[model samples]
Target: MNEDFYIDPDIHQSYTLPASVYTQQQYFDVFKKELFLPSWQWLGGKEWSDSLYTQMPHSFLPGCVDEPLLIVRNQNQLSCLSNVCTHRAKILVESPSAKPFISCGYHGRCFSPDGRFRSMPEFEAAQDFPSSKDDLKNYPLSSWNDFYFTALQPKYDLNTILAPIHQHLSSFPYDSLRPEPNLSKTYHVRANWLAYCDNYLEGFHIPYVHPTLNKAITYEDYEVRVFDHCNVQIARCKPGQKPVPLQKGDPDFGQNIYAYYWFVYPNFMINFYHWGISVNWVLPKTTDETEIRFLTYKRNDIPDSDFADTALDLTEIEDEAVVESVQKGLMSLTYHRGRFSPTREQGVHAFHRFIYTEVFADSENIAP
Candidate 1:
């Protein structure tokens, strides 16, 4: 496998990322370390903040970047710390429960909720024993409204990636929206995670794959806007539907918008609809399998029936079929790569370019 892959800055001239990126085990392993480990991950909203799950033990990117982590809530503050003990590497928090501090079950090593070294039964006589090394490792955590995100080492700013959503939908009643447990679902797709994202990064397949969705949104008016760390696909609503109420002076003001499909690089999607927000977390389980978590939150003011058709489970099934087929096709020897459609696939082009840059950012002459 080549360590370097080039994606031309000009979409007209550039080719998509090679098939190996989605098919080869070597590339998959490298991506888990170079691409995902340093990228922000979405940790569900509000529930992490509730007093009920103060000491929740989370497996960071399970099956991919499998790292044990603990979400510690101290008063109103939240912290992401290494769940492993400093002494014997035992997992400190096995499950979510209300706990005042962290204690290792293997021994008597204890630490404060904030991950500070507090006590260790057998270390009193040891010199430099209760030093910084004794404390749990802390990870970076960021929030947008009620939602939370964390990273082992974030490569892009979470705020910058989420700016498009905030800028276009500032009037959105964030506080009024609450997670709907019944609406949330996990889909296991038989495809490379990137294949699912590539399918999501464009509206080119809507007409071909999602016939029901095509009728609700004007296909010709679909627009893709690429930002520093993210991209958005803006769909114009059909004649009878109500558009998102953007603040006056905004570029999208007065337009009958259907939804803003925002894709944050690496693997996170936030879709804003008439009734609420739908989040898709594309989690890579293996080179050929991905776990897609569909998390929904509904606004208190909007009736259940007002939710957009795009939010339907049928749409997800349509997407899964297309993506799974793409995954299979990528393994074919005849198809190694393809060119980007400048007008229609800018989001897909941007996504491929990001993968090239992140995977081979250290290489020289990557341009063209």
Candidate 2:
């Protein structure tokens, strides 16, 4: 398996990723280190006020990456850091606290709000004991609206990677959106994470599977816009439904654009609706299991029909059924590869190309 492989760059001339990606444990275990860890992913849709620091302790893609992360807030600045103490490998910040200081529970070591080492007990006699290495390891952190993102070794600047999101939503008043914990949800799906992502990257199944969402959206006018490291699917509202009106100079000005289903590279999804946003994170648990989290942020008052829990549940149920079935079908030796609709599946194709380039490229160039 050390030999390098390739994913055909041209979608028109390419086959889908091997079925083993969704069915075999060897592939998952191998890719877990080189690919998933360094890639940018949504950490449980954890939203924090960029203006204020909120202690947010989250596991990165819990089951698959399972990296314990700490989001620290000191005064007005925010940062993400390794939750493990470097001194003795002890977990730090077991829970969120309002204090403006951090202390390692294992020893008397202390760090400032920004993760810089401040003080240590009984180290006066130690030669050069306190250094930058003793500081809490910090991760790169950034935000778009209420969404916060972090990566240990991001391949590119997150601002550059998500430029599409910022450009498309530049004119919107999404700043009004506030985190609503009561509305967030999590679901365990009996399917591989990639299988779940595959289903999410297309809308061809909406009419067949999601009757409620189908009624809310017009299938004819929907469009998919592909970008580097991300993709956007336009969901125009059906008759009688309202959209947060677009302003002049906005990309979709003068259109009843109900939502923008934005899928960032890998497993993060930001579904923007008039009422608010439904942020989805696909967390891989095992070869055939995944945990999907839906964290909601509301901008203002929402009508029951536009953003109701029951409506969301119905859509999820339909999607889960289809993705789970696909997972089962991939187990068949008779089915190994399939083609994509050149028009409808560009997003899925783009996602596959990204997965291949990052996971299977000359791994010698990858960081250890």
Candidate 3:
């Protein structure tokens, strides 16, 4: 409820959303249309290989907004299809598998790997026979390293959003890093997904909220660099921590350790840690609820030990505490909006600007 901030048009600046955006159900309803549906998001990684097609259907977003989808490696091409049967809309592919074609258990409607309608029980008299409408809905899918990405209404190119990070990390052996299932976990937080993202946009609270992690990385050397709808904060690791060599001829050479914190606009965080990489995806279940999925990949066969588990758990719990508190505070009747620190909050500002552009672009009354 700090009111010292103003939206500066000269520099193309704006403040973060007021508390109501996180607390009120009405606002959250609009947020889904204005923010979530339009932005490019991280679905899941490309861990499902060609040989693993006929396994079990994976839940894309389970429990909250359960949009069941099927992933199949058909004719050597990876395809994602809506799991609902084209005949009666019954859920198909209950589990993952390597199957030649997807058959609906309810009525025998069959679909090809590319989501095309192939056969049905009694459809000979239909006028639009084998029409595209009968096929499963297909979403755009792309991949980086072994990680797969998708978008609902992808307005911008994935390459444009991820190009800089890709160039910087080109030489790093990301593909070599294997998924360590034991290290991955998910947390259901009682807060807006954006609230969680705001907490991650800066290192300002690190010295207080994450004492151990703060000590491991120097806050003074922390620098936030903004890109197109994305930002990267480079945090130099404390001495004695293992160092990750920068790509040859890269500008960030000679650094003892590199902690690359990347925020893909809307709600995905890809953190390049000293050990390997960790992907944090914030999925909105409702106005005041979010599901955070943490997937970790490791290099050099690092064993899953107590120290590693404790460090990860502590970091997550600390983040949840802060974000959840912020969500509650945003619900207060007296709260409104707050100012941004010009030096430390560039990431937050960049994100707000991106949101305004995506949401208010068509409104004639709103200034461009």
Candidate 4:
């Protein structure tokens, strides 16, 4: 295999990994270990906070990933717990609803809202009846502007990842923004998660792949600003076109904007428009399959009729087609890593640097 397919940092250029990275199971395994587990990802919003506070447990991943977890709100405090019974390890809280306590359907093991071991059936005869291990395992969780975030491995501090966006978005009233459920949708793409992200990191292909979107935003005025583990690409609106009004004192208040595309590390993209915000979460299913979830939250109500039919879907379809085509081409023996256009693809280059640092940093440090 041509290992040089991986981008060489020494080259100081924007280049992608060899095609095998998209097609090989070995590469996928490495990514799962080195990338996903350690990363802080956007799971769900705060809509479930009330339910959790009511002792109604909701599961994050069901059958596919099958991580049994429960969220509960008690005494004005919210907590997440492993949804496994303390007694026989039976799963707890299969469905979501308000309940006073959690009881295993199998052996009658019960836990309090805080995941403390409350009761067990027929355990009086046991010698070590009440050990600390009987309590459900709790995970670290934090909330920002009505959004709940958690991590499994939690290699880096959550604040480090969120600090930049928090500082940038401080002026906006994010807490008041209600999620528009009708605008939310998920699309399955036949490409790697990174490939989908690479497509998003730059507007290099907008003129070619997205003619309609290209018309909306001036291509020459496009600019990318990079931050730690995140990048913001400003899409300048055409002359004479009115831009979305920013919150008072916002730096970009007067600038005309077709869109503000913000990509957070690993797998989240916050796309801001005059009308509202669209949060895109990209989840990798397999080596070659990815699921992209788009959650649209309206900041300002704009008539759906004002835009073209299937506007979001068309953009997604165009993106899907191109990324899938790239995935296929990556498998060819002749194709290897390619160069990055510094002017147009700084965002993509920044992303590649992040991936390399996350995956191979330790390896590089230990090597001779």
Residue range 1-368, candidate 2, lDDT tens digits? 22223456677766787687788887777667766777777643334553333566777777787788888876656788888887888887887777677778888788887888888888889898788898888888776665667787787777887899878878776766777788889999999999999889998888999988899889987899988879999989888878855788878888888789999877888887787788888888899999998888777655545665577778888899999999999999798787777778888888887877777675653333
- Per-residue lDDT, model 4, residue 109, is 85
Q: Against the true structure, whose lDDT is highest?
A: 1
Model 4 ranges with Cα > 4 A deviation: 1-14, 50-66, 239-242, 247-249, 300-309, 364-368
Q: Which one wins by lDDT: 1 or 2?
A: 1
Lowest lDDT 10-residue stretch of candidate 1: 359-368
lDDT of 1 at 76: 76
For model 3, the stretches where C-alpha displacement exceeds 4 angstroms are 1-14, 55-66, 301-309, 361-368
| lDDT by residue for model 1 (295-338), tens | 88888887777875444688999999989999989999899889
Give each model a TM-score.
Answer: 0.95, 0.91, 0.89, 0.89
User: What digit string (tens of lDDT, one per residue) describes model 4 on residues 29-139?
Assistant: 677767766766565665565444455454443212446677777765677788778776777876775778877889888888878899887888989768899999987
- For candidate 1, the per-residue lDDT at 248 reads 78
**Model 1 off-target regions past 4 Å?**
1-4, 308-311, 361-368
Q: What is each predicted model's overall lDDT from 0 to 1?
A: 0.86, 0.79, 0.73, 0.73
